[model samples]
Target: MVEEAPYRRIAAEIRERIARGDLAPGDRIPSTREITRDWGVAMATATKVINALREAGLVETRSGAGSVVIDRSSPQVEVVIQPDVPAHAGGFHVAASPRLRRAGEPELNRDRVVSSAVAIADAEGLSMLTMRRVAADLGVATMSLYRHVPSKEELILAMIDAVFGENPLPEEPPADWRARLETAARQMWQSFAAHPWAAEPLSLTRPQLLPNVLPYSEWSLGTLRELGFGVDEMMHIHLSLFGHVRASALNLDAELRAREDTGVTNDEWADQHGDELEAVLSAAAERFSALRYVAERGFDYDIAAVFESGLRLLLDGVAVALARREVSGDEQVDLSVV
Candidate 1:
């Protein structure tokens, strides 16, 4: 129902080119930035154009390859003209390599729509995700995506199911409980790192019921249940483990975006801000004991080192929890409950 004025402009331009053989299906088109520079438009406007082409089934965003036209011979190509791209966009990456569905296929469904949405989020950010934006990416009517999902929230939840489902954890875990949990954490971390945008929609305390996510929960709970804990206790422990991953993963997306925007690491940014930090420290050192202590320590720690240390500390806590479970009458838990 929503109308996209800017996306319409993008669709219109690309349609003209395709019809003229200036660009063909399977041909890689310029990236959003390239398109923006070529067309002399703002970055936001450029992003819309590419997304629109994607929705129309004319283009697809591929890592290392950029955006490519979906296919050369497809059924829907003749029917779809310049579809409008509604203003605004958004979403996170699902997988490093996406399975290209095809160009101009009538068999489009929810999975394809959500898949494209995930691709956009992977390439861009969650703030840019919208039904209109997603449709623009698919090169379809904005209304077309509505046939499968009702709202962005529903789409996001389904995306989590679809994306997370693609990488299922082991039904059988390793012998060491810590090692098994570490494996689980690493997998989750890789998922976040690959699709940094995945974390933006997730809430730590109020996670939605997802089959893929639930399995991890089942594994965690089963691990605890064998450790002489009741079902409720197991649930609590399961939450704690899940909380660790989600909370840490939450920062992954923002950190990556900050990197892209500034093209600097956190320490680099801090080094650039060193003078400012020095001034603030000088001013507040007298009032704050913590500031005086660090100043007296006379050390500037690398942020990357700090991040790694923090990660170690987090895992250390898990190790401690496991150790406590061992000392207690708690029996060994079977973590692999797939």
Candidate 2:
């Protein structure tokens, strides 16, 4: 007779309680923190216990709420996929996938914690992301999260690293310096677009030293160095490119908030209030000629296009500086003019 695993045994106990109706549906279940205290088990074991219960279709995570018993009578229940556990093995029939981890549901770890935080920040703005919110998203105890991440600041740092790590820099970048710089800038832009909340935290003035981001810096700076640019020039150019992306990305969160609050996109919102805007512009046409001129023609705003155009202009300026440096024999090229 082999001994059952501690996690399985604890899971069985909870399962029995649920079956007996002692832990009724819609009632909050013991969090991982509670389970560890009650069962005298490790936090990982506690997570496994919850994983088992969740896999059995006995509980579901509610946003802004912790795990609760699932109502058997209800037609739908949120399902959390466990990587090791085969899907639809014993749980209720899942009609659709929830906006939760499924493709690769690895065990709870720092990476998982960071990924969850990223997801939350991506869906909702960073302002709305909290420890409790991430815990609820993971269907684990908020305290258990601390075992993996010491603090929210640490978790955020980890999140920044994780986002940057998604797209690896090429080992052999494009031979052309301009092409290399453009490649790096566009990659950074894509990352910010994916997780709009990430841009602000990745500061320009007081930059967070992220391991994954170091390669990008090396690639960008190395490209400049190969082109004979001085260290000062390299840093300035790199920052200029980085800052451009960050500046555009900074608006992403605010734009997202407006869309969510107003339930319309920028263009839609403008159209909805177009008459009022036109009336104001019409009244102040002489003073606001430029505004009225563009307003009359209508501006189609696309952040991606704006970012690309800005990147091109910045690189063009860099090219001019390089040209000046070549002619001046390594002397510092003045960048005050175009």
Candidate 3:
């Protein structure tokens, strides 16, 4: 119908203008007066067309630019589709998938929102976790998510908790402290491998005290205590070891992704760039006059290799610590840097 064709055909024209570079981001689309004149449409029809573009998030008005093209180069955001009601999904039954919150509908609860967010981050990566993207996934206005989460930081923390909670730790205790620590460490590593996004939210020195994480620490300290160590020594060993494990494994997923993105084998990069690296060092020595005095470590480690080596070294240090502490007259056992 000509009456409704303005809304239908106009969007296609706008999209074409964008593709052909006749319009670009920050360039204004035709005003209602221009649309009426050019399209030979009624005033109300032009208004409807413009409103449709706004709702589609294709254009926005700026003070100087008027109703300009939206930046398509900007990252895409999406809301999740709600799970359909099953024949037997009762009110009391737990929903297996996330439920999207639509505007003017009952606001979705926090867990559903967080669950949906975590699923997206898991499938993609941490950088994909944006307010606009999550809202689109939920089929709601971007601002609507703010009512559920005060900020994106809070949303990230919630996502970490949800994903971590999925793989619960084994209930039983191990025969020795070493065995227990090994089990816990392996579990944590595997859990991180499951969701590569988990690494970004965690901190080494200032970790958020998720109760789930605390249990592992408590178990670590308790094991030390059982080995006849005092609370002070226990804290030192446990915290230090935890820090080592985190440093070694936290960024494993990120490093792999980076390697894939660069699309150059680590060895090949080194081979081609080795001369460039030397040239840069020589230039720095000539230019700065301070670099020639210090000894260079002369080492470039493959990140994948470092990950495994660091893990082994940390466990070895822990082994040495346990041995020295158990010595009869070791004179306080200087185990630092072991």
**What is the C-alpha lDDT profile of model 2 across 71-178, one tens digit per residue?**
866545335544544443223233322224444566888877887688657654576557876775676667999999999998888988898898877778876777
Q: Which 10 consecutive residues of model 1 have the lowest summed lDDT?
A: 89-98
How should the candidates be ordered by lDDT, best one leading?
2, 1, 3
lDDT of each: 0.64, 0.75, 0.62
Runs of candidate 2 with Cα error greater than 4 angstroms are: 1-107, 331-338
Model 2: lDDT of residue 218: 88
Instruction: Estimate the Cα RMSD of every predicted model relative to the unseen true structure.
Output: 8.3, 12.5, 14.4
Candidate 1 regions with alpha-carbon error over 4 angstroms: 1-59, 63-106, 230-233, 285-338
Residue-level lDDT tens digits of model 3 in 200-286: 678766878885676777777877776667777777877776665565555665664454445466656667787776677787787
Model 1 Cα lDDT, one tens digit per residue, 142-161: 79888999889999888777
Weakest 10 consecutive residues of candidate 3 by summed lDDT: 85-94
TM-score of 1: 0.67
